[model samples]
Target: MAASKTKKQVRKSQFKLTSEQEADLRKVFDIFSKGGEESGYGTISAEDIKIAFRALGYEPKQEEIRQLISGVDKDGKGLLDFNDYLAIMTKKMTQKDDVEDLQKAFELLDRDRDGKINSGDLQSVAAELGYFTGTMAEDLQEMIDFADKDGDGVVSEREFLKFLKKTTFE
Candidate 1:
């Protein structure tokens, strides 16, 4: 499936938060919502959105913040309610966690720290994980071939992410 289609499907899907998660998110929202005298009791401004994301361990770019606010601020009043905040946080947290996990996996495979995973990296990682059978060279090469979209004989970070997303979500 196309990345755009996957994104749309993700948006259409309902993301649930546990009661504990909801309470924690609410606490963060409330703290930011009451930051200034002009702040409302249950709404947060765009700046508050940035701070809230940071508090939640995400360092979103300014453009990302603007896009999120534009997408979720239904009234265009430059403020977000708890429901809007929850939606943004839920989606963002999910995406962040997936990307972070993928990144960590990629880093583990890229043992040489060369920013790309060659067959040697894959072989080393497989050996470390005790998965190195005698046919390891061919297996590692096949893995690299599957993920190396550019046919460069290695998997770059972008290719690794795209490959995993395609395989996992499709």
Candidate 2:
């Protein structure tokens, strides 16, 4: 007997949003799209995402949310999104979490595949985020060092997962 594989049908794009959902999502976008409103980085903050999800009656894991937000990392620069807020939020289902999403985001951030986010990439991402300062490079490098437990000068999957877990939905 021969086996047949079923191809999944793909859905095209649409831009229809209920007025209330649109308003709430937009509010969230504005909050995140702003640079360093709280932290010195323009990157989307955890607080911003929590508010957004709360508006939608949802409480997603922050790391999961970051993976979802990664979809808005459109320029392949490993930076967070600022312009595609509404489109990304509306397309949330495609950004849902899984082990694969975790791996992908990590890979994207780790430009050299040395198992960690390098200071150069981090600084570039932060600058694109409109939040970079000379000292931020040192601070982020320290975070990398703190997170990279093996002293291999790179963050292994285990280390990354530990950090990810800290951001997960309880």
Candidate 3:
């Protein structure tokens, strides 16, 4: 029987923290926030994110830091409350189904909706993802060359699907 298009698909459960982990995360959140939640003044700013990244031994660029902050700063208020922090942590912690994740990633990267991803396409996506740099053109070129199985100078949807399947296995 053919599947019913009207049926809503169910996703896997999202990540949840243990009580001890939640406590630890709360402590970290408090440290990053301006004040306690009860005071209605607690929020982790972009600077807080940068400091936390440094503390975790990562030296991200300003754009990357902003992008990371945007993912969790729900209100776009340039800050993240505890709930926002929890949401970001949940997204980062979850291990989703590979095919589904790849599809979503591909759609995000294929901004032009032309059913293919070229060097220009990758460059735009990298810029939005906060990875643009002096060497970004070369990086995108290398990625295209590596993934373009048909040697068409671009990655077609078929090629992308194949690459995703192989990468998932690896």
Which parts of model 2 have CA positions greater than 4 angstroms off?
1-96, 167-170
For every candidate, C-alpha RMSD to the true structure in Å: 5.3, 19.4, 14.3
Residue by residue across 1-170, what tens digits does model 3's lDDT show?
33432221222242457798667667767778886667745888767876755543445678866666687776777877777766655443342344557777788888899888888888887788898886879978999899999998988877887896676433
| lDDT comparison, 2 vs 3, better candidate | 3
Error of 2 at 111 (Å): 2.5
> Model 1, which residues run further than 4 Å from truth?
1-15, 34-41, 111-115, 123-159, 162-170
lDDT of each: 0.83, 0.62, 0.69
The TM-scores, one per candidate, come to 0.65, 0.38, 0.42
Best-fitting candidate, scored by lDDT? 1
Task: Identify the candidate with maximal TM-score.
Answer: 1
Q: Native-vs-model 1 lDDT?
A: 0.83
Clashing pairs in 1: none
lDDT for position 2 in model 1: 50
- What digit string (tens of lDDT, one per residue) describes model 2 on residues 1-170? 12332211122133356789677665566565556545434555444666666666666777877776676666645445444556556655333333446778778777666766767767777887899998787898887898777787667777887777555521
What would the per-residue lDDT of candidate 1 be over residues 1-170, giving only the tens digit for each residue?
A: 45556653674475578899889898888887744434444777888888899888899999988887888987888888888888889878777867888899999888999999999997787788898887889988998998888999999999999999778756
The 10 consecutive residues of candidate 3 with the worst lDDT sum are: 5-14
